[model samples]
Target: MLSLTRRIREEILVIDRQTGEQIVIAPTAYRGNQVKIGIEASDRFKILRRELQGRERGPGPG
Candidate 1:
């Protein structure tokens, strides 16, 4: 894992060289020890929390 320090509104981007797709993340808010982040990515990407990665998926309410 790579770690870097970023101030609020400063962005870090990750790109896929093969597909030319990218994700931009930034720190939007911070209070005490908690932080709120903002991410910008295309619809082709699926983003989820680390804790929910292994959970099974089911249909949502209709």
Candidate 2:
């Protein structure tokens, strides 16, 4: 696992070396103790929050 610290609007990109696919994540908003993030990725990705992974269905294998 990797950890990153980014300011709002600063993006961190994740790339799949094999497929050359890319996902961009950035912090969009910040409150006192919470932050909102935005993600930009191809439709091939089934993006989900960690908390929702258990409830997600029909997710194809990677």
Candidate 3:
């Protein structure tokens, strides 16, 4: 895993070696304990928040 420290308006680029896909992640704003980020990627990519993953898909198999 790669970790980076970025300030507001700063960006990081992520590339996929297999498909040559690129993704850009930038911090737009920071308020108190919350931060807003912007992402640029192709439609082939799906972005999701960890907490919302299960909820969005509904109850999982029991």
* Residues 1-62, model 1: lDDT tens digits: 99989999999999999998889999999999999999999999989999999999899999
**Candidate 2 local lDDT, 1-62, one digit each (tens):** 88888899999999999999999999999999999999999999988988898783787899
Best by lDDT: 1
Q: CA shift at 11, candidate 3, in angstroms?
A: 0.9
Error of 2 at 29 (Å): 1.0
Cα error, candidate 2, residue 8 (Å) = 1.1
lDDT of 2 at 46: 86
lDDT for 23 (candidate 2): 98
How much is the lDDT of residue 18 in candidate 2? 100
| Model 3 spans with C-alpha error above 4 angstroms | 56-62
Q: Candidate 1's C-alpha lDDT?
A: 0.95
lDDT of each: 0.95, 0.92, 0.89
Model 2 earns a TM-score of: 0.79
lDDT computed for candidate 3: 0.89
Cα RMSD (Å) per model? 1.6, 6.1, 4.8
Better of 1 and 3 by TM-score: 1
lDDT of 2 at 9: 98
